[model samples]
Target: MSETTWPWGAGTATGIGSLPGTDVAEAQRIVLGELPDLPHLPELPDRGPGADLIGRTGGLLVELPVELYAARWRIAPRPGKDLRRARDLMERDLDQLAEQAEEYAGPVKVQAAGPFTLAASLELPIGGRLLRDPGAVRDLAGSLGEGLRGHVAAVDRRLPHATVLLQLDEPSLPAVLAGRVPTESGFGTHRAVESEVARALLHGVIEAAGVPTVVHCCAADVPLELIRTAGAVGVALDLALVTDLDPLGEAIDAGLGLLAGAAPALPPPAGRAPTSAQVADRVRRVWDQLGFSRRRLAEQVVVTPACGLAGADPAYVRAVLAACRDAGRRLAEE
Candidate 1:
């Protein structure tokens, strides 16, 4: 997508959703302060149960209620305590976001588990994984799509001046495509899904959201082409995990914005942090290696940590976010 059509501006920086603490207000403050150009709603998995990625996203489903059963999220017959708790936690987070960003304008992101990742994580009512039943997976995708439409609308209502961007996290997509997802009995694996099916489902959700969408897959061998075909305006992944640069270069050349995870999400050795120039150089090197123009880096790339900071030290979290923000500015200045 062109810079004019995209939600984020040149040299913008953003996080990959989750943070380490349970203080929603504090997290929102930090995100807004650090990433003024493209702040995201902070997800605090530290809150337990319904606050985690799957549970929180599952709570948003239109009709398919989910509950924590046997230590995993499972489709429930109806709305229950677990589902209610998850939705409540999300509502509280949104309230905090509204309060903190009352006057903030620009692109703000809201995230969720993508259709394939949810399929791999959520269990069926009858005991097997939702991935095992194709029909049920389709139904789940539809529900998620409709749910995301409502979610985008809700965010827009709360932050009236901000343009909402949807991010779909698909950490399990590589496993799903490789047929590595374990069966319910743990004795076998589910069948691999075709790329076309995955693309179609993802496209459905993106279209339903009615906003610019980015697909984040931090794992190795990220399906860059598939994500681009699935209609994501951008692809977010760890730059370190990318062993093959040709696909990345191709994707960028095709006008796909890159959320480059060039900074380390984990704490640096001896508690020392890298400078902004050092962080920005990572993307510059990649651009040079790909033979792309330096000018395009500012327009097509966003600096971020390699992944979520949910497990990083709190001090390191702040440092990393600052590094990302400064790095973006460095890229822009170049």
Candidate 2:
């Protein structure tokens, strides 16, 4: 919680969430091997149905239940096979992680759909997205807060030696703020959520987690100041999409963590990943341009892939993750 106590220690690296395959055991092995300092539980969205971000997170809710209907996720009557499969897959993943990293003792990250994104994606039983109803959105946030607390506690209990780090994935946050989410009819757009409301919703989940939390969005229009003010300890975004550094500077000044997405999520045309020096150079240039002290770069920043590794092949995913770890080591040498 303090500026001096970093969960991943100094100049470490981590992923944005999600891996390349369905083999949960292999995912854990690669993650722990490549990013030892901040290995995260791999999200296997490829499992389909309940394994995707929305269903997986919805399955974690305490009372609220959701189901797939006509290709949309709506509030459900009860936990169906789809959602049951999701929770089962999650349990299996944890079981595999516990077996693989039985002796691991470090910061372990876990991710889920953030409250704003969940509301935008989940359909209400009354025939509309939850984002269209303020009360429904508030209620969903409360539910997610309670669910996340339990999820984090479960991870902590499973890996007692490791510190659990929560990463809330809100890739649709920019659209949520821009009023770009389409209505159920797919014709009209929904109203933009006010900044105050957005901050409160995010704050609720973060507070409920009761641990160091990071907000990750790979979009170009990330709300750096909003998440920082909402109490997120770290902000993860695609470095290639960012240009202005004023807000990032302020965040660093305030002791906020920066998960710099410097490596390519997809394979490069050159047919090989960037070297450690090359990857760290991008972060160094950004730090220099931001007028930050070089000495603090390792303390306040973390190297990561530009986004989730779900699109890449298994080999490419491992290379990108290894590149991130090497980049962090290079940064530490400075």
Candidate 3:
């Protein structure tokens, strides 16, 4: 990607959407205060049903509506109370973000579940998961694309000074690709999706988003090449979970930026948080192992926590965000 097109600048750091709190206002304050350069809209799943990853994204669908059925989000014929609550939660978060960041003019991120993850998680109206029905999957993808386009526009309108960046969370993508997503009965798994199909659907959503997009999958064996081929400007994943470095190296070489999750998301043992140096070292080692130039590290790499901090203690959440920010600055200095 060209310098002008890349959303993140050197020494930029950001969160992976969710934070540890039920208060959206407080979460926004922490995010804006810590990651001012690349603050993401806070996702507070603790707020209940509609605030979760799947339910939240479901609310964004253009025409497709979803409702909570038997504790699982299912496709519904029409918008219901559950769907309304989800949309309302999202709207409130945007309002808080716009209020807090009225004067900010840098890159701001907003996250939603990716097409594959939503397909794997959401249930079909008739039965089983949307993943089982090819036609439903296609419809869901198209709906999600349109939904994301509107979402981006809404964020742009709210934060006119900020460059809105979209991050698609695809934590279940590896399972969907590997046929590991279990069926509703739990007796068998859904059929694996072809790489070409996955790439095409992902590409459509990226185009629809109409922003500099990043795909975040913190699972092991992240399909780096596929994501890059699908037109993502960046890939976000936990560096610790990466068992293979070759694909990562190849993707970086292919001009895809890296949102490197170097700081641990969970609280450390004995409450010993890693210093900024420790967090920076984690990413530096990866770059050295990949044999990438140090000069490109600051520009091509962004430091972040290993994953969402929603499960973490509030104090730990603040520490991790600070560590990531300082780590990014450290990389720039080096």
lDDT of predicted model 1: 0.91
C-alpha RMSD for every candidate: 1.1, 1.4, 1.1
**For model 2, the run of ten residues with the poorest summed lDDT:** 1-10
Evaluate residue 256 in candidate 3 and report its C-alpha lDDT on the 0 to 100 scale: 91
lDDT, residue 13, candidate 2: 95
The numbered model that scores best in lDDT is 3
Candidate 1, 222: how far from true, in Å?
A: 0.6
- In the range 1-334, model 2's lDDT, one tens digit per residue, is 2346666778799988888778888888999999999999998888787888898898888788888988778888787877787789889988898888877898899999999899999998888898999998988989889999999888877888988989999999999999999997889999999998899989988998898999999888898888988999899988899977887888877878899999888889976877778889999999898898776888788899998988889988888888889889888878
Residue 293 accuracy (lDDT) in model 1: 77
Estimate every model's Cα lDDT from 0 to 1.
0.91, 0.88, 0.93
- Give the TM-score (vs. native) of candidate 2: 0.97
- Clashing pairs for predicted structure model 2, backbone only: none
TM-score of each: 0.98, 0.97, 0.98
Over 141-188, each residue of candidate 1 has an lDDT whose tens digit, in order, gives 999999999999989889999999899999999999999999978899
Candidate 3 per-residue C-alpha lDDT over 1-334 given as tens digits, one digit per residue, 9 for 90 to 100: 3443478889889999898779999999999999978999999999999999999999999889999999999999999999999999999999998898988898999999999999999999897999999889989999999999999999999989889889999999999999999998999999999999999999999998899899999899799999999999999999999888999998998899999999888887878668899999999999999998786898899899999999998888898899999999999987
Q: Candidate 1, clashing residue pairs? A: none
